[model samples]
Each structure stands twice: as structure tokens, then as C-alpha cells.
Target chain A: MTTSFEDFAAGQVTPLLRYATVLTGDPHLAQDVVQECLLRAQQRWARIGGLDAPGAYLKRMVTNEFLSWRRRFKVHSTLTGIDPPTPDPAGRYDERDAMLRRIARLPRKQKAAVVLRFYEGYDDAEIAAVLGCTQGTVRSHISRALSTLRAADRVKEAL
Target chain B: MNTEDLIRDALRRQADLAPPPGPVLAALHRPRRRRKPLYLVLATAGTAAVVAIAATTFSRPTADAPPAGSNRPPFSTVTGSPSPTGVPSGKLVSLEYAPTWLPDGFVEWRRSLFDHGWQRTWRQAPPDHSPSAPALTFEITRGSIGSLLESADEPANRTTVNGAPGVYTDDGLRWQVADKLVLTVNLDNVPDARGTIRRIAESVRPDRRQIRVPVSFGGSTRFTVSANSRDDWTASTDVSYRDGRYMAMLHSVAHVGSSPRTVTALGREASYEEAGGGVLTIPLAPDRFLSVGGLGLSGFQQPVPVETLTEVAALVEVDLGVDLSWLGV
Candidate 1:
């Protein structure tokens, strides 16, 4: 069945924006990236809509836009200072917020691989396809990212 | 309590940051700026002139002309010194001719559009990490075709293309197809080179078209964009100010090499350096970077401040999802 661009975009934009948000760590930039991708997709929706998995295709587009958005503009979320999460009443560190900040600081590819794996639940093959790299490269990216996060965890434990 | 579980939970929480899609959808519905009419005017003028020349040269009656549709030599060759033709004055904005036929397994793989001409290449297979791979190239230029023929190492074998005089040499076939138009076909490592070159040259037809680049700039109106190149995986553009005071180049290829320093631009860490002028390399993807180099100069030709380059980098708008397949050869 041939789906119109409007219908496809209307149905897919939310999920795409979510994925982009996690990948970019910036909701506003995520919106901009998703909108830009959707506009481009609309420009050639006649061909994209005929694909067997237009949603997946658009997801890949969102992934690529997130990957490249930094080069096009200054990405504030990644570099701008973030206030530390408020300590719980018990005075324990907010591990989740700390981890999110660390993940945001990871290199773009490593962050993308980790998000695709943990957040998107993508296997190495699928992540490789989206990242335009070999499965071995994807594994390397995820491994390096986990190492960085783990090192931070050990420092917290020692302190 | 494990790191994997912690990461997942954190990511889910971050996903909630995604805003509603209403604003984005509304932005998409807004009208876009129309492309300049200069492109249309140039395309129409170039096409009409080429069509007129092609029709006149090909339709001329000759006693020795082969019967219609039969596979025979359409024009005879004569030995003579090719005359120097006047160079065309205007910039070439559209491709005016394309090969109507190619060898059985050939597929276009690269294309470059410059101010004075465009070149396209076709290969039997992907270059596949081999720069020396065999291919065929078709080029049309309004620049000096005589210079190309003059630079040939071997003597030229004079020939005729559709009744107009041309030259055939070891490198390729060259024909002054019109007053300002020159067509050249280069065959490399192909079998039956002589026959292939002749057939390909004869099969040329008018195909006027322009490439819609994936990147656009909403910067100053004084800057005019020109000279675009694209291949299988990358594209680039050159923009220069009218008075030649400043120029900026944008490239899609990543700058993986190390730089001496980094500076904040567009709120991101960008590798900065000053070789000839200021160059900024911003990470676009793990494998790709948008390289914006500024050639700004003061009245005394001194390099301008790096801030000007930063501003130029900010003005670039990239549509990462645009299907660039059309820009390929």
C-alpha cells in the first residue's frame, strides 16, 4: 500500500524524536534534527514510502542526523555545563543522572552505539547498519563506551 | 544495580525530554523559499543553443552519409590542424549532454561540476579501494578545449563528429561540437578502445540538468555559491564573496587528523587552525566532519580574525537526510 508522506510522518515523528533525543541528549536539537530529516524525507517520499520498512528507514535517517548534527551546528547539550543532580536525602549520589552525563560526554560514535544497544535494543548487526560501520567496529565502540562508564563507576566507589 | 540496567534507565528518562511534534510539523508546513530563476534562465539558454547546434550538425545532408538507423560511419575523417575557437564567457550552470549509450557493464560512479564544465565517469565495477581502476570519462567544457588537445603527448588523428571536424588521439576523442562547446571522451584500460570511443562519441545526446546540492547556506547575500563536486560517499561546495575578499569551502569528509588546538564554536568543540587562513573542523558524525575554511582577508590582504570563520561555519545548513543519490554520477 502506498502511504502518503503526511500520514507516515504523523505516525512516526514522535518515536523518531524520542530516539533522536536519547541519541543527541538534547530535546530541542532532537526536534530540529527530526524535523529536518522529515522534511528531506518528504521531498522524496514517493520513493521512501514504497520501501518495505519506511519507519525503519526514517529511524536510520534520524540516527544519521543525530550523528552529524554537531558538525552543522554547535550542540549545546553535549558541551554546556549541566547542574549536578540533587543529592537524595540520604546523601547518595544520583547514579543515573551521573551516568547520563557521562554518556553524553562520550565520543559521538560511542554514544550512538551505546544508545542503539541499551536504549533502542538494537543488536550489533542492526547498530552497525545504522552507524555505517562493520559489526566489529560497533562492538569496539560499545566496548570503549562501557569502559569509560565503568572507570567512572570505580572512581565513585573509591571515593 | 548493574551498569547496563543503570544506562537503560537513564536513557529512558532522557527520552522523555523529547518534545511534542506539533511545532516541527507546523514548521514543515510553512512555505519554503523558491530557488533563484537564474538557474532556469541559464538552463534554457544553454539547452537551446546546444539543441540548435546538434540539429544543424547532425541533420545536414551528405551524399556519403549512411542510411538512416544503419550502423555505419556517420562522418568521414580528414587530416587538418584544428583551429583555435573562442572561449565561452558565461559560467556553465547545467550539464548539456549525456551519453545515450555505454558499454554493457558500465555504470556511472563519479561526477564533478565546475564553473566552466562538468565531468562524469563510469566504471564496470566499483573502484573498491583501488584508485587505478579502469573507467570511461565524458567531459564537456566551455573553457579552452584547444589547450587540452595541445597538451596531448602524441600527434592527433583528425576526425569528424556528425560532419563537424574533431581530433582523435591516444588519450581520447575531442570534438569542438559548437562555437563554445567541447566534448571529450576518455577510455582507460577498456577493450577495443578505438571502436568503443567512436561509438560512445556518436551516441551523445542533449541532457541538460542541474544537481540540487544537499547543503545550503542562508548566510550573506554577497556570497555566491559555485563549483560543486560529489562522488559515491561525499560532496562539497565552494562559496566566495563577490568582491573576492573572502571565500568559504564546505566539505562532508571527516577530518580525522589531529589538530594543534580546539575552540568553542556553535557551542561545540571544533578543531581550529590557521594554515593559509582559518580552518574549522566540526564533528558531524563519527566518520564525517563538516570542514569550513575561511579565506577572509583585510584591505592589506592580511588574514582576517578567526571569528569571521566561526560565523561562516554557523551559517551552513545541512539536510542530512536528503537523498544524494541523484547527485552521483
Candidate 2:
């Protein structure tokens, strides 16, 4: 039997929130994105309930919502950009922590692509599907993004 | 540790920084609908179901195996298992190509990542080093090299090495090896580097240590993914049958505002208009049809041939993620 809407929501909302947090890099924004998407999702519960992978379906919605937030909500009026995690003193920290800061500073699509590639363990094709572009484009975006993050290493080595 | 492992750890740590979601759970109330369902049963089914879901915990949903007969396999908090887009588990080949011959007093100085690939540099001895020092740099790009659109500006000379086509310049040489790799050499102020660059380019052979996969174009250029509905009413799917090369999108609609010509697609009646981002609509169920768009797209955007669109409609087996069958009804 298919799980009811509330049961599905109750069971799945936390993970959705968590994924959103990681995606948006802000817990509050993550909550907003997830809540809004879920509100929209509840309206289509019937069609969604019959789907083979309802959770996957919902996750994709949240992802799109997060990706398109700038256009959909006119968010640019108030918020210029998401605040990046603060970098530590370069000499004290290793590449991993430094890379983490550089990662947080990546542009939205680039950040999303990198996260999907490295953190989510998705391939170029999968990432292209998620981010809505060609695999070649995904490869280009990932390659460019990672190259920027490596700049910190060059600085570290020079020191 | 590699970049992948380090990134995974960092992300998980960032995820840990998120405050508890307990408040969000307590506030999970369905929005009120403006249009009441024809039957009271419909209007209240969702709110009606909330009481039953009260005991459910906001933990992992796909922890257990789904009941048998389900097309989907068991899932976890991780990504779905059925995703065909598998990340390459096999190691990528990492090999550096160094020229067999270098100018006397030249020392191998740097090996680092270059644009879309790797590069190795050799700087001349300090006695030869002035404000302008001669150096040799070889860049080998490993990803999607064959797709590089030929440029009109380069007065590039066509050249080949070992049957692989390349371009040669006075200063250096460039090669697109085996359609899977690209190697370009630039003589950055280095004198008498042409002969060495050509030798290195010609001597370059497939490496055993490099990550190897059966190279094929049929699969790499194609992709299939289930689209998630932006909302309940709108339903759509895009099939990149040739991956990035060609893309076809189908949106659910009952009918179009303008008229169209009817044609047979896979023996079923279909309608298509060829002008202005061409659209082909095929009747799937009564009052519900799949409208395919993204036709006649030029440049990098592959035009979806009408026959390909028909074939896609004919071959569609299941509603990928968002069930389009219920749309536009």
C-alpha cells in the first residue's frame, strides 16, 4: 500500500530539510525552500503517490526550487549572495578546510555541480540531469569550479 | 585523501552544522485549497490523512525494502539505487608526458593542473635565465577533447602523428589523440622547441596506468532522466537521447491554443507545427496529450527531428518521475 501524504511527509521531511540545508548552505533558507516545495508537493499528492519513486520525485522538486529561487522569488532584491563560510588563517589549516571555504564561495550552479559530483557521488550524466544541461557542459562546469578551488593549494605551497 | 573524499567529509560536516529540524516538523500543515474537490472525499483526503500519520517519525523513509512487485528496489537515505548514471568507480588514468629530449641546462620544474588537463613545465638554467627565461609547457586535457569546436581564427596547419590528427605551429604542436584525449604544447619563449614538441606529440602513446573504459560515443552522448514536477498541475519530461547532442522535451497539455497538422507517429495520430520552436503533440489519453518542444534549435542546441520525437513518444514506457498521465485531464 502507498503511504499517505502525512506519513510520507512526516517520514521524509527531515531528510528533505537536511538536503536543502546542504544545498542552500543556510539552514533558514533550507527550511524555507523545503517548506515551500512541500506545500506545493502536497497539492499533487495523488499523482505523486502513484509514482515509482515518490521520494526521489520530491527531492528533485526541492532541488529545482533551490536552483530557481533567484528567479522565482525575486530574491535578489534583498539578498546579494549567500554568505560563505569564513576561511581560517592559511598557515594553520590544511588544504581540506581551505578547499571547503573555496567550495562555499563557488557560484550557485558551479557549487551545485561540484557538490553533486564530489559529495553526492554523481557522474557527469547524472549531474547534467540534475542541473539541467549537457554532460559536456557539466564536465566543463565541474572542471572550471575545481580548478578555482585548487588556487588555495598554490598559495599554500608558495608559503 | 583525494578531493572526492575530502569534499564528502566537508559536506557532511556542514550538514551537521544545521540546527535541529524539530520546529519545521511541528509546523507541517497542508495549505488550504481555493478550489474545493467536487466530492468532499477528495477535498479532505490529505488533511483527513494527517491524523493517521501522527505516529510516524521524521527519520529515514526508505530504510526498509519496498514490498515485492514494486519496480523500484530497496532504497536508503542515500540516493536511489536504480539511477543508471553510475559514477566511474574505476580510477582515472593519471600520466604525465615528459619530452625525451630537453635543452641542456633545462630542469624539470613544475607539474600542475592546467586548463581542463595537466601540464608539465621545464625552465632553463639560471645562467640562461634573464628577465625572459625560456621554458617548455605541455598541456594535456583529458575530458571531452573531441567536442572542441574548430576555431576559424587559428591559421592552424593540419598535422598527424601515429594516425591521430593534430595541428602544428612553428612554436609547438597540438593533437586530438584517439578522439578521447587532447594534447597541446606551447613553447613559452623557449628556442628550438619545435622538434622536441613534435617528437613528444608523436611519441605519445596510450598509457597502461591511465583510467581506461571501453571508449564509445553511443552512450556518452545520450541521457535519460525523469523530471520532477515544479508543481502538481504541470507535468513534463526531457529525453536527451543523444545526451547533450539532442534533447526532446514533452509537456502535458489538453490542447494547443493554435491549430496544427495531424500526422501518424508510430501509427498513432499526432500533430506538429514546424515553425517557432516547433511543437509536436500526440494524444496519449482522452483529453491528455504529450506536447514535445525544443525543435528546430540551432547551434549547440541539437534540433529534434520530427521522426525522433515520434519515436520518443512511441517508445515511452513509463511516467518517469512526475506522472504525466494525470496531467491536463
Q: Give lDDT tens digits, candidate 1, residues B207-294.
A: 7553333343432211111112242143334343333222232233333212225776555566764432334555543433454543
Best by TM-score: 1
Model 2, A89: alpha-carbon shift in Å? Answer: 12
Query: Candidate 2 lDDT, tens digit per residue, A1-159?
Result: 876665566445645665665666644446556766666677888889888878767777877876765422221100112111233475222345345556756777887888777756779888887788999999998988878876666665699
TM-score of 1: 0.38
- Give me the candidate number with maximum lDDT: 1
What does DockQ come to for candidate 2?
A: 0.09
lDDT per residue for candidate 1 within A1-159, as digits (tens), equals 887665566456656767887887655457657877888898998899999988888888887766764533223332112222245574323666668868877888899999999988999999998899999999999999999999989988999
Candidate 1, superposed: residue stretches over 4 Å from native:
A72-74, A78-80, A90-93, B32-329
Worst 10 residues of 1 chain A by lDDT: A76-85
Predicted complexes: DockQ each: 0.15, 0.09
Pick by DockQ: which candidate is best? 1
